[model samples]
Target chain A: MEPWTTAPAGPSSAPEMPSPGGNPVGRVEEVLAQFFMDGKLRAAATDPAYLTLWEALEQAVAGGKRSRPQLVLAAYQHLARPAERAAENAVLLAASFELLHSAFVVHDDVIDRDTVRRGVPNVSGRYRQRALRDGADADTAAHAGDSAGLLAGDLALSGAYRLLRRVRTAPERRERLHDILDEAIFASIGGELLDVELSRSPVMPTPERMCRTARCKTSVYSFEAPLEAGAVLAGADSSVVAALTSSGRHAGIAYQVVDDVLGVFGHHSRTGKADWGDLREGKRTVLLAYAATRPEWQHIAHLIGSPHLTAAEAEHIRRVLTDCGARDHAISVAEDNARRALDFLEHDGVPSPLRAELTALLQGVMDRVRPE
Target chain B: MEPWTTAPAGPSSAPEMPSPGGNPVGRVEEVLAQFFMDGKLRAAATDPAYLTLWEALEQAVAGGKRSRPQLVLAAYQHLARPAERAAENAVLLAASFELLHSAFVVHDDVIDRDTVRRGVPNVSGRYRQRALRDGADADTAAHAGDSAGLLAGDLALSGAYRLLRRVRTAPERRERLHDILDEAIFASIGGELLDVELSRSPVMPTPERMCRTARCKTSVYSFEAPLEAGAVLAGADSSVVAALTSSGRHAGIAYQVVDDVLGVFGHHSRTGKADWGDLREGKRTVLLAYAATRPEWQHIAHLIGSPHLTAAEAEHIRRVLTDCGARDHAISVAEDNARRALDFLEHDGVPSPLRAELTALLQGVMDRVRPE
Candidate 1:
């Protein structure tokens, strides 16, 4: 059987299969699109100024893989057969995750001073370009872009809670959902702060610290929180919630590991980010930590964080990373995490069909990170 | 009767009346102190890094007159005879307001590039100092400070919601509180964004636009939302809520108008900010708008928004504003707003005792801005 036939559709699956029958991802996209339209109308009714804010928000949230929302909806579907109202609530919950993700993305771009995302000028970049076109000097234009981006992110953050408030659920369940979201947001901010600090610190961080950063920054929001939010909305039992939480934690770590690996090795066309961007930024990744243990690092350490690092230098770094076994180490860690996620699902008594689906989905993600 | 004897204790009242029988503001301070202690403990338990964040947030919140929280608690006390549980819930709601305010203050410093607040280094300033001490370049230090301040604000914003979630109120009432807060946050952010845009634009904003910005930025959160939150917690009727909202809106506008006036004319020792800071930043206040219509403005227009504006230049601009009648015009507008607020309270049938207290409180605040 084809991979997607046996598993839920994910990033690698049928791109043209819009609303492919049982696909929750397609439904999530539809919900997000409708939400954008409704938001536009609301903004228009309020003030013309808000209309620009809503437009920028819409753009910031657009054209992603919808992975976080997918996790929410899929987790909900796997746990319960919801009635119509419950199903709608699931979509709102899913949309809230997307909004939260957008908040992080917009702010992250500003902090990283990144102008492009997904191969296009991001929210800040678009604003910067507009200001420059309107005759602002470079410094003024940059400040305007950062201000616009900062406010857009704030709107998205607040909008996430607003969306959650509108989700029609029992007050108790809604309260629980708010708790999960609050914790995730707190953890994510902590992680982002730590990441900033580590990047600037003169001393290199320990591998343990790096791993903790990954968990705080990526896993909590990207996996554990969304999965838990879905389970709470579904009124899943404690055992099921715990199982999914564990499963998601491991899977999230795997996702980040794979992401770090792809940051250096994946083709620019495939990743839609500059292949050397992470290296240029001197990001502290698991691959980098592993490579630090190798003798090969000493020769090219000075070139690692140079903004003007040439393509040839990057190619040399990539070769050194592979030869020093750092690339293989990262892949193995991802595979290990993927297995651990499946193990939790199996032993923690997730229903058989759901377990099979999660396992297959995780396997598909892991497949992309495996060495050819 | 003396203002303190007739009205609630405010900033201008006795500082040593710690728990003078019915002092809501005193209780707010006590509650905020305890909350900070609890937050520090919680952060210590989580990670040492977060200790810095908690410390910065504590400083940002410290030294405020507790005016916003005072509004929340005082409004609640006047509207309803609360049981012990209801009283505790009121304090929680009040603290949430302070958290929201802190969020705005920290982010505002980043947006305005202001290094000092309340006569001391703000959260961003502290972080920037630390980065510089660590020997980072000026640009890197500034970026680091901004990133830290940005995340700290996000934490405080999220913490506001977290505190609200813990309030032990009826679910319906809690929902209403969330709605009020969400609207306030949305409005405040809109106002802040507009302020940034106006300051950056070469063209001057209209007086109407300036007023709208004040309403959206200051009045909504500072006055309207806190009052509404208190009333909702007290289960006040819709008419009462509407009356208070109107009263708060006018009071808030007057407060901002007074603040703008002080930004230019007040002594630095009294205002705890540079007297010329607003002029240097070229804030488009109603005072500025009114002055723009006068022929005298033509001579001093170039002096506005100059980063290196001297005390002499600022004094010259101040004289021009007075000579052109802009200062008088702004004071008149503020007085009008203050009167409207009192009028709303009287006509809206706020109980006699509460009406007296609110009137005296607003009058006390207005006295500071009234022309000598």
Candidate 2:
């Protein structure tokens, strides 16, 4: 049988993928930790002030899910023969995904002017706080903070390429590695650009349009590319690569759809997001687009993007969304996307054990957004 | 004769380097043009709004000196065998330098909050204008503009790596190609980080400290790395590469010194810089650092870094700097560095024809910065 289409082996035949050679995700963490350590050393050598950037970067990325790297490992292990899998190299390549994510989240904070991220002060927020402590005025402090964020994000972006380049892959595959990364970055930026514009546009985007943006902005890089990169690295056939990539695309959009729902509904403790932000900013997510289609939206439309959105007003908006079935509407869309993602694994391209693992991973991340 | 120690040859020995290939610099420009054009198409295909970013990038870099690419060509031709001179590949590499520059300048504008670049509105400025014209408030418009700049700069940064990766070169040298570019980017970012921090620091940095910052921020990638990359591509010995790299470092510092002088004294018409900005921002330039050392600085010290600095106050500050011998002090430092740069050619590693071309290139660029 073709390696891509092989049947799943029993539990014994399933190699220890994530924990192979003892917790591979731990290796990705180590790569990141070491990369930042060297960065700190270099910054200290250059000027002590630069250490602030490296420190902020290290701090911001410290508690990430490491999902991207895990995806790489899963795809690689599923496709590669035991002899072909170089666990260490796979870890390095996977680490690059987290680095790229750091770059995106950092810059996105700057664009959104968000001081807090993941229930903590983000890179810009940290810098801003430091500047304020130094007795600079609010404006100067804000400028300093965002500048640091911009510079730090640049480092992470370039640093991602550095980590990717370090993976000891075949010479023939190296250029493809870089090409996939570049393409993913390109699509992600486009998604970000479209997303912000949609919020600011006079005409509201439809749910479908928002979904397209989600696929471009979040799904392509976050899900599709990582899976594709892993398959490509494992030398999977092109058809298998495409199938895996398409599956990832659907899963990523599902992730985004659920993310939008959680942004307004999930508690800060549960999701690391301020429930007030998405509604206050008038972010045109699939959830909001669904709500826009309801007659009740007219009564609460002003509440959606109010700069001084109160907890009371937000609660009222949330209630309206739920009553109008907008909440369920958005949830069903996410379910459809997630189901579509799982369908790809059910077919010939993926192994059965791989199928079960991907299904679990998708459900785990999306559990909060899914119906209890 | 050993290639590194080859004696100066007559007219026949000198190959047609820059023009022999019929304006390779134009090819570099072509590569950049095509890259931006494709970016625009992709943006258009995704959403028309993204075209604004590609347009801003294309415009931001259109009138550049192309000095970096020329430096590459000179270094490569000076060392490569006639048959080894693949001009197209060399142009692609050189063009990456410019792409990186575009990223730096765009991000720097966001950091500096500069509205104008090269005597015109910059990337942020353009986006800000469009937003305002569309009826957005001042704050909203400014946010839109900077967001665009930030996103566009990210594209350019990634785009540089793409271009660098595209250069077809010897397999052994490939990793080195990426390594050199990464090292240069790392140093350049370090330089930018320090440059901002220096201007913001409460304690004034000395002229020596400022010069070191200049070396990291402007010189590393601009001059040193380009020459080193070119030499490495042409398969120059490590020693030759080191010499040329050192030569570029000194020359780059000279260029920065002159730029500081120009920032305060050179007209917008001449240098494409706002004469008032450096003084208004209390920018801790090498020139200002020298001025701070003179006793006369006590009389007008308060005017520096004054956010509301008047035109007359700026004129007074310029005169104080000049009369205090700070101007000559800076000019002398620039001259010393330039002389040091040229002295590298006086050694055995470089050939005479290459020496003459590099000399002309250095002087031509510095002519505006140097005294008549």
Candidate 3:
């Protein structure tokens, strides 16, 4: 089977082709795969053991559709003197984005103590299993789990650097790209650190704070950096850069809030993971916004934090969240953000074709955030 | 008191200065202190929480003498035209070396689950204590310890990249420096993984294989990378680079083996840490070379894995090591490597000043290795 065939949702329902041509998204994925394969070879050469780490990274990159990279290339083509060189830089940028994503996921898995990810044992979890299979005692296996997972994350971090080194653009453009990436990563880690600490404390996570965290941790790199890098390479003016970043910030946060919603209520078949894993883990999300404003939530808040809450109890808590209107309120917030993102893009001078594509992408993502 | 004044071991017996009229090694310590204070301010601007991570990194970096960076600067001075610009590059390089060292040590402590490092509670250990002190339950505290430690190491890793970005050299030279740093980090992690694995299986860590691990893990970055980067900045020839790398390979391995010895029987006042911490933690070192070869040692091989081995038991093992001539063998190996390092520098046309400094630095390290 093709690597993309194994995506949690099998395949997305978005149109494969642009109006005037063939399957642009599929072509993007094909190009991304080849670019990633080359980057993987270079990463593997960092050390012999990185060969194994690279395999894990490939799986992580393969599961995502080529939406982000396609957006970058589409935008670049709209703004730049499109050529083979432009196409090549887009692929390199896409590959670097994938590497950056892998770094975050690997580190996130460790923080979340997640044993399985994307329907496969997470890197650290796999290492733990290998130790057990090797007849290591319990303590040894546990230590091996933590260490291996950590090293795996470090390897991924290094892989992102290696990818950046391969950017064949002008040195000044490359340096700007590097700065954008470095700043985003540093901020993301800080945001993650704040996020985990907030979850551990008794304070109710505000919707505003959650949105801020989402923007820093997920939005910038996920939506803004890729687009900004592409635009910078295309020598887009300051106004275009500002507009894209604004759109990306709002849209990315909306995407994350929607993801949080899906984490609690989406189908296991579509997500390819346990439904309500977030609830089971007591994760704080934007859906808690209504609860924070409601006096009735006090009783349920204590219940949610109860040390002995069972899966059925977690289901009841989820029901209470819906009953208090938090779930719907979160969806509304996400819709507003998505709408704002599209509204911001309308002021930019993006070419008609690409602007239409951006509009559709934003609306499609918003439409999918559902209670279904 | 200034942090340097409280350095774990005051002045470390004042290793003989490498240059007759140059600044004392204390100047290196002062430079480290200044860099750390500036690093703290930069980290605080990013996030106040990062200040904690920076302090942990500073502590780790401060404990070691400025051997490797000094070697790099000394080599640079030998070849480079005397200029303020060159001196600035040398300091930046020295700071980079320290940052790389800090990254390695932070990660190493996590891998080892070390509770105390350089006579202070390790970052992980301190976090665990703080969690418990703050009334976190046992499991929560344990998890916090592991998580915080992992993140702290990541902080150091990120900080290294930030330091590297400031290397204002030719793009080609910068790329070469970047490659050296990247390769050293990956290889060191790989060697550490191997060492941890081998400890559980109880194999004869052959001198050659162990030395190779040292060369890759310690020597290349610690010595070769800095020296090569300096040379590239100074525009040195291939012959100088070759001799430097070869000599570094010998000294680096010898330094680690000597460090392993000191861990077993060194003075508390001089090393500024528990003399037998390695034995208590069951680290497999070259000092075990003698113990592993003894008939008497076979009886206690299982006990070596015990976490609760006492001071007396550790001393007994040390005695067995002395009796088996393994200690003597390790010393001989160190001396041989030291000689080889010097011999490698005995070329017809090396910069005379650099050769003398390299000779002094190698001897200073070798002098600390005691015979059985």
- DockQ, per model, reads 0.59, 0.68, 0.35
Residue B311 in candidate 1 has what lDDT? 94
lDDT of 1: 0.77
Worst 10 residues of 1 chain A by lDDT: A1-10
lDDT of 1 by residue, A1-372 (tens): 001111123454433112212436666677778877876786666457667877887887874556677678767876765453377788888888888888888888888877676656878898889899989999888888887888888888987887887788777888899888987887788778878887887565666677677777888898899888988888888888888998988987887777778778877655556788788888878888888878987866777778899999999999999999989988888888888898888754477766766676676567666645
DockQ for candidate 3, C-alpha atoms? 0.35
Which whole-number lDDT from 0 to 100 does residue B9 have in model 1? 32
Taken over the whole model, the C-alpha lDDT of each candidate is: 0.77, 0.80, 0.67
> Which docking band does candidate 2 fall into?
medium
TM-score of each model, paired residue for residue = 0.92, 0.92, 0.88
Clashing pairs in 3: none
Better of 1 and 2 by DockQ: 2
* DockQ-based CAPRI category assigned to the predicted complex of candidate 3: acceptable
Please tell me the TM-score of chain B in candidate 2 relative to the true structure's chain B: 0.90
Model 2 chain B: weakest 10-residue lDDT segment is B1-10
Write down the lDDT that model 2 would get.
0.80
